[model samples]
Target: MYRFTGSWLHKALVRLCASLLAILGLKLSAFYFLGLLIVLGLHREQLLG
Candidate 1:
């Protein structure tokens, strides 16, 4: 019983860490895409001008 409880806690921690990492990845990608859009927008004006 004790071993089971300990293993469950370990699994829970692993899952929490995985979820946090996923959220961080999403945020990083969003920021990267936004920066890319801004850069593209700037280049568009230069190209059109």
Candidate 2:
């Protein structure tokens, strides 16, 4: 019974960590995309002017 509970807890913890990492990764990618867009806009303006 104790071993079963331990395994359940471990699985829950792993799932929690995976979700947290996924959220962090999504945020990082969003920021990266925003920065890329900003840079591209500036480059476009420079080329036009």
Candidate 3:
């Protein structure tokens, strides 16, 4: 019936959304960590020079 299909579709949509957000979060965290490393490197160079 329509109700069953609707519930299934809703569940699928929620799962898709959760997966996309998780991927996005991982990329963001990686970018942040990379930027932090660059900043630390610059700071170290400044201190040494």
10 residues in a row with least lDDT, candidate 1:
40-49
Candidate 2, which segments miss by more than 4 Å at Cα? Answer: none
1 or 3, greater by TM-score: 1
lDDT by residue (tens digit), candidate 2, 1-49: 9999999999999999999999999999999999999999999999999
Give stretches of model 3 more than 4 Å off.
none
Question: Candidate 3: RMSD over Cα atoms?
Answer: 0.8
* Model 3, global lDDT: 1.00
Candidates sorted by TM-score, descending order?
1, 2, 3
Candidate 1 Cα deviation (angstroms), residue 2 = 1.3
TM-scores of all predicted structures: 0.93, 0.93, 0.90
Candidate-wise lDDT, in order = 1.00, 1.00, 1.00
